[model samples]
Target: MQETIDLAAGPQHPNQFALLRQRRFAPFFWTQFAGAANDNLFKFAFTVMVTYQLSVGWLPPKMAGLVIGALFILPFLLFSATSGQLTDKWDKTRMFRFVKNLEIGIMLLAAWGFYAANVPVLLGCTFLMGLHSTLFGPVKFAYLPQVLRSSELTGGNGMVEMGTFVAILLGNVAGGLLVAVPEIGHLQVAIACVALAVVGRVVAQFIPSAPATDPGLVVNWNPVTETWRNLRLAHGNLVVFRSLLGISWMWFFGAVFLSQFPSFAKEVLHGDEQVASLLLVVFSIGIGTGSLLCEVLSRRHVEIGLVPLGAIGMSVFAIDLYFASRGLPPADGLHLLAFVSQPAHWRVIADLALLSLFAGLYSVPMYALIQMRSQPTHRARIIAANNILNALFMIASSVIAGALLGAGASIPQIFLCVGIANAVVAGYIFLLVPEYLLRFVAWMVSHIVYRFKVRGDEHIPVEGAAILACNHVSFVDAVLLMAASPRPIVFLMDHRIFRVPVLGWLFRLAKAIPIAPRAEDPVAYEAAFAAAAKVLQDGNLLGIFPEGGITRDGTLQPFKGGIMKILETAPVPVVPMALTNLWGSYFSRVEQGGAMVRPFRRGVFNRVGLNVGAAMTVAETTPEALRARVDTLLRART
Candidate 1:
């Protein structure tokens, strides 16, 4: 066993790159990075060899890419469930070493296959490499949450995502260049692949021990049964399951563009092979940029609000690409320089890069959310299930795009249709899980409507049941609070607020607990308390405006007894919070009329803040005491 906490020699800043300096993260990061690079390098080299050099009748040049891709993904479909279970049942550091050792052995075999110029042997190596990746996926994802704090999830995931794409990009470029060498291209590729494998194994030895999440678990070797079991485990949590589907949908969406890039560049852009590679480089850079931005945009927390924003950007840019690519003139095999020199090609390049960038922003948060929220014991298996879905979605995307192209739809038209369809599919997913939409709205309000900030946010609980008692200054106070907390906070609101048009619809969408005065509606009041208690019992945060309603004046209202009544049922820690600089805003009653009467009363990006205070234990939680704590926060500047 090893220490669960990651300790470093010196104090580290909050920057994501600071992780590279620590023992706990650096070695594993490099190990995985080497593996990713080696996989792409080997696959691309084999692909070039098959398509341009070899002439086996059964594997034609046209079908070689598809066949190789299918062979690579097949292992994920067959072994991912078992691999996830294995990940949970063994030390993760041991798993990394085992996978790297397997890679080295596989690469040795691959060197012989390349030297002998045996197509079957090379194909077998591809499947084996795929298996290597299938095993590495779950452990790589599951290891992060075990070592990093909740506050670090966004930044940590961002770094990994960025590094993976960059590795893949570098690998592809190296393979293309190395395999094109005059006489010793094949030999050079073999040596490079073997060397990369050796490097991965060397780095794997340094990863700190991450003890088994489920050491006592029994092994289930049957992929069929275990795959089903793994998926069912994921489905056990509605949010996690839906998130799995959402991420798979992203893969599906991106696959269409990635698969079509070669065709699009040659046919639509009238560019050479080099131009296609240029497009790939641009797209990879965009993804890396979007991924690295998540930590900064989210303030180093797992903020799913970026998911919807990313989805919207993906569609917007993809559609713009359709219009940009339409009515382009044919050119005579233009290379990278000539292609970019033509101003007409710039929009197509920009669109491709932006869509891929949005894809990065869209995916990192969901991945981190799954990592943070899934049961530690079952997290790897759920991630394995996610891999299964991603592979299936990618396959579906390829088949559908191929069929559409075969049916004579132009590449731009297919892109247009997918862009339109992305909006609908994403909208449907949001409907099923309203949390994404709620967070999106809150994210917009905080990012666009005001320069939102949080202080003492560390007081917010990461796990288990807790009650958030806050001084509600304005209608948007709940939104601000949602923006600040790393995890979702379900609020208990006055029932009357739910009838206020757009605000009401939003509250209902959030699944807020709607309470009324006990005298006016006793049944509804009791039902609200019961619902609130159930939320805590289920180990979820339940938020309340301890004043019972938003304040009309910029003063602290007395805490109501409803909070005390609910506390008697489930006496969890009470976190006091406050919102400042919002009372005179448009959402408040400062003007003669209420919200929407005036826009940006204080101007966009107004200075607004949420202040969280130390949590109060049940024994010290009184109406007066809670009010005083919240009052102190309300008066204190964040």
Candidate 2:
């Protein structure tokens, strides 16, 4: 077995959706899709049966609904902690196989319950299904980060989420139709569920066994305590924790609107069950469309800009949903298909789709961000926190909806109120976490106007620490490097240059390390060396331009000793890279032979290139040898 991680270096995953096509990832995705379908199909069947078919002599409507919900969610609340530990301790493929087998058994129980017409047995089956889901949850999320390239995380998660939600919509619709089949009997629904389970099992069989990252992980069976502990791990990083919370809040917002849909259709739009179901279809399509569109809008990168955009769209449509229902009378049990053709009902459809679309845009990035930022060892635990919070938030949404209804508000009114609340929630989250907005700005600026094209990126190591040697191309080189390279790059620069009026502030804000040449400022130079060593020790990439200043002749300058000093201390790998064509770009100085620097001189839309060379071992690196190698590499690329 390879003890070290395999690195797929530079411009990897050209097709952002390649994760979906990989053997390891395809099985995992189908497993999730199958699980989501099963969950929704079972829930919809139970809800429709209890609401429309059951003779509720003893149970109240709300009480019956609550009991059904409890049966479905309780297992997640109870077994999720243990499942999370299992995902960490065992080989994920074997564990995933076990869960798929468990699903087949649960589906058999469901069949038995349906045939016996036993509500208690059916409810018990629901709990077992939830248990299966809870176990699969951690493995589902944690496994993605292991297989996908860093650049592919957002697109991969987007596709997965899109598939999951779309499956849910199909499952719900299919279950309703299946249960109504004549002569075929209720066994049809049971067979369908079993068939989906069989498909899921087949997919699980193809999954490559992912080795455990934390094989020594201890099992934490106590749900209450373990849940809190998992939450603490998620909370360890402010950005990651907040992103997780944002995801939960979105669920909270979604649950509120979804729970009241039937009422909204009947009381507000004057339609029947079919119309309410149509509203669900609209929302599902909207969300799935928005989720899939994320890859396009973001250019397969994580662009938090859309988060704010989605929030705005959600609020706008939600408020419109309220106004559209104004002056409308309650339905006198009219069938939805007949009523939906009326011109007045289009507003509801528009509202439902827009709300779901924005929600899709809003939620996908948070998942991507969490996957990108969280530590590998604890990623699954954090996703477990997400699952726990999703459940809690959904529960709270029900409570909130109940409270609003009890206070005598109409369904349309509740939607309008929540839409307004969504706007407020979004604004608050963005304000509290400005990084999302900032990253969007940076990402767009680089990808759009500059059209950065990196060449020879394979030279960078896939893992471990490395010091990057580059020919300074422009003021934005560090940010460009940060964006181009999958790993974060810490740059060392001249203190005076870093302190330059406006550009200096930008560099400081980006956290670039500043150093003065030893003859000019010995203290700062020593500090730079120390800082570079610390960064390498922490397993981060450090970028330094050997030219020490922009080239006057647009040709290579001899490398300085800083590279030698850093390598002596850190002794990791030294990867040489070159930036060409950017010298004539907007951020570049561009003046030849003592000419003063110009600002935005060439304007945007300039072509730029970054060429990276393979890692140089410490033993082979002396100042002369390193400089010669870098010069040769840069010249060859240019």
Candidate 3:
């Protein structure tokens, strides 16, 4: 059984670096880092061998690359569901130990394959490695949320993402360089793989134990049925399922770009292995930097707003990459330095780097969201379903790229096509879930239009249900609160506000509860309270402007009874929040007769403050008391 944890207890680590200093996170970090590096190291070495040194009478270079890709991806399709079930049924830390040990054995087989120059054995090892990864994938992600506090999820995921890409960069460079070292290339790769495997195992041994999320879950061995079951579970939740699609699409986008790099470098730029490695380095570094930046940009929240921003950047930069590389002079055997010497090539590299940076922005939050939203009992299985989809998407990308290229389309054309497709897909997704776009707008308004400073935000619970009572000072009060919050909040607003044009659409998209005055519509007023109660029962944050509506004056209005009624029904902790310095803002009804109502009346970058007070118990949460607490917080400068 899962132990009850206090969701109100904030994160132990303020940043990713603090997480690295803790044993609970560090060991698992290094273990996964080693595993990612080893996987790429072996895979890159094998690809180079097939493309350059191997002379298989049966398999051409292209066929070999295709076979290798298929071999690695096959395990995900075949075993992800089963792996998910196993992770849920068994102890995760013990499973990690076993998986790491399995890696060592796989590396040993790889060594023999390299030593004997056996094509079949090398391919078999690739398949085995894929299986190893499939088994570990669910555990790797699920383990983090279990160990880290809710507030740390974003930062922890950022560290993992950054580490994975850095590992990939190192692996690709080392593997490519080693494979080109004449006769002893295979031996060098074999040694490195084995050494990395052993180090990974040692690190795994130090990983703190994390109990299984669902110890009573029965293992389902049938991959076909289990895969369907897991997918259905994911689909049951619209947000989680859409997040899965978003993550899979990112993989599809990345696969198309990364898989084509070597060929693009050779055929388009007419560059050698070093140039390919340089491309990998630039892209990988961008991803790492962006991943780390998510923590800072989000202020430790799992901000999905970054997803749309990432999608837009990816499309724009990808299209630019096509244009930048469209008419480059092809110089055969051009090295990294030579490629960089040209000014146009720098544009190409810049595009690649920017695309990758957006990819990091695109992916990390989705991962954190999935972890945060999914039912804990089945989180691992949900992740497995995600892996399955990711593999399928990547495989589909290769097939699509091959078909497009086979039809005489240039690499730049493929890039352009993919970029256009990304924009279309992103539009469809944003339409389906307007909250993503809404949040993006809220984030932008908070950061760009109004400079927001928050204090005592930790007073809001990270996970459990809580009621937030705040003074309503402006029309955008809820948007500002949502922007400041680390978790998604359901706001209770006046029904009239829900009828406003674009803002109403966003309010509805955010699932805000619309309340009417009791004198106007008793039924809707009662329904609103019921909705607020349900939100609390469902373990979500619900925000209410206890003043009933935006203040007509610049000062606090009398507290309404609706908050007491909602609290009486839900009996959850009430967190008092204050929004300050917005009485004269554009969104505020500050001037008499509303004559001064206009956008940017205070100009761009108006200063605003949000002060969150400690949560009060239901017994101490009368409207009068809560109002006093909020007033106190409002009076203090944030």
Candidate 4:
């Protein structure tokens, strides 16, 4: 059972931000924040030292950043599988403390290396810090859904993502500042690293105990076999596995831009290092802003609908960025001020900001969805799978981008190629999992075409098999219903309705059931019910028009026995719903004609609503009772 979030909390204390004051969230946030900041602080300080302050015989200045990055990423590839298993077998709070303690130890060693100017020791410490992050990664996501209710997942994830990016930004800024502090720079870097690690440990002490989900599971020590097993386990649920890939692809996409930032700023924008830092600042702030906005945009749920929206924005801005890059005025040694003084550069900044902002939106919902949907026992392992994939994808992005550059592709051309590729990739993913595209369509129509609102939406189950019985009002009724649900709803709609333009294509994409009257076509009717039964058995949501068909007379129609037929096939709970104010919509049978007759009868953003009633037990559900429930809901505010 999940804890109830304070949904009625006032604006001043929005439940998402209010989490900052609560024990369950605040401590974990700070602990993770400190760890991320410290990791970046140490790495950046070390990179700066190797690049500018001193040059070792083996490590050239140009290769310093790449070497440190490769070393840090190596641990994720090697140990994520093992870390995930430990996270599941041990108490999460204990794991948190252990990781924090390990951080402290690593930072202490790092302190000595910094003070002594020991490049080798610092490099080793960098890998150790990466190890610390790897150990902590699986537990961090797994711990959240353990404490937060499903309703709070998106907000919780949004806050954490925003915090993580901000922390990384601050750490990099601090690292650069500390390591440049004249003669005392190295000493300050060492002191700060140790202090931050200690602070992280202190915060870790306050995280509430999250009991092991799979206490008796035997640990798999082999990275190769264990990694393969974890990936296979995650694949048991196709959506979850595909989502893991989606997130990894996002990392790949983001890394391309991030890796090119320095070159992009210096070569293309004709700016110096300060200008490069400015680009970083813009990108970081954009992502943080988008992450924070997910909670509001999703209305505090794990809404994958936003994923498509985010993907579209990412591609659009990335493509625009290519064009924006080509038009910048040529100049030499232009500092931050000089770059900003030109109007053309503002487009570059805007394009970069919006592109990164969409990346944030793209990722947070998937992370929350993965956590919410995975088996609690193996959630950590699945997350570990995600981490491993992320590492691989980032490396691939670097290799591919490097190859493109080596093959004579300019930075702008590369951007254009990535932007186009993103669209094709996103389309393929949506096709594989139609639910994503379904949700995107529903969300777009409900949020844009109509001023859609929902009442009693919580009665809908987030998982498992359940029958949704809504009074059909228009051709797009299923689309609106999909908007109100977090899960994919396989709507059992009337066969004739599938002939409606555009909507017909969408329903086919959604794989909605098209049932004929048993008397009219017994075989088709039987097949529809059989398909619905399969959906229930597969633990998916099934939707039906309990009134048999859309009302031609703008009033509640007599109840049909279709709902009972579905329940008889699978004894899942039936949720009664009503769509209000759709009677006179353009899609409805109004003005003595069906759809397209009064196209402007209801303008864009027209007020409409879907009112959901309580779920009825199989024993309590009947055609008449379901009708009465839906009728009451329809009459509530009409």
RMSD of each: 1.5, 4.6, 2.4, 2.4
Off by over 4 Å in 2: 1-22, 62-66, 147-152, 182-185, 236-239, 267-272, 293-365, 368-379, 405-438, 494-509, 516-522, 549-559, 590-604, 619-638
Candidate 3 per-residue C-alpha lDDT over 1-638 given as tens digits, one digit per residue, 9 for 90 to 100: 32323434544666788888877789999999999999999998998898889898887987887888899999999999999998888778888998999999999999999888898899999999999999999999999888887668888898999999999889988898898898899999999999999999998888877888899988889999999999999999998999899999999999999899889999998899788878888989999988998888887888888889999999999999999988888688898888899998999999999999998998998999999989889999999999999999999999999999999999999999999999999989988877788778878878887888889988878889999889998778899988888778999999988877778888988989899989999999899899999999999999999898878878899898888788777899999999999888888886465623577677779999999999999888787888899899989974
Clashing pairs in 4: none
**All models: lDDT?**
0.90, 0.77, 0.89, 0.90
For model 1 the TM-score comes to 0.98
Give candidate 1 misplaced runs (Cα > 4 Å). Answer: 1-12, 591-593
Off by over 4 Å in 4: 1-13
What tens digits encode model 1's per-residue C-alpha lDDT throughout 1-638?
Answer: 45444433335456989989877788989998999999999999999999998889999999999999999999999999999999999999889999999999999999988888899999999999999999999999999988777777788888899999899989999998998898899999999999999999998888888889999999899999999999999999999999999999999988898788888889999999999999889988999899999999998889899999999999999899999999887887899999999899898899999999999999999999999989999899999999999999999999999899999999999999999999999999899988889889988999988888899888999888999988877777778888888878889999888888788898888888999998999999899999999999989999999888877777888888888888899989999988888878878776356665788666777888888999999999999999998888878984
Clash numbers, per candidate: 0, 1, 0, 0
User: Where does the lowest 10-residue lDDT sum fall in candidate 4?
Assistant: 2-11
Model 4 RMSD in angstroms: 2.4
TM-score of each: 0.98, 0.83, 0.95, 0.97
Cα deviation of 25 in candidate 1 (Å)?
Answer: 0.9
- Compared with the true structure, the alpha-carbon lDDT of candidate 1 equals 0.90
Q: What's the distance in Å from true for residue 49, model 4?
A: 0.5
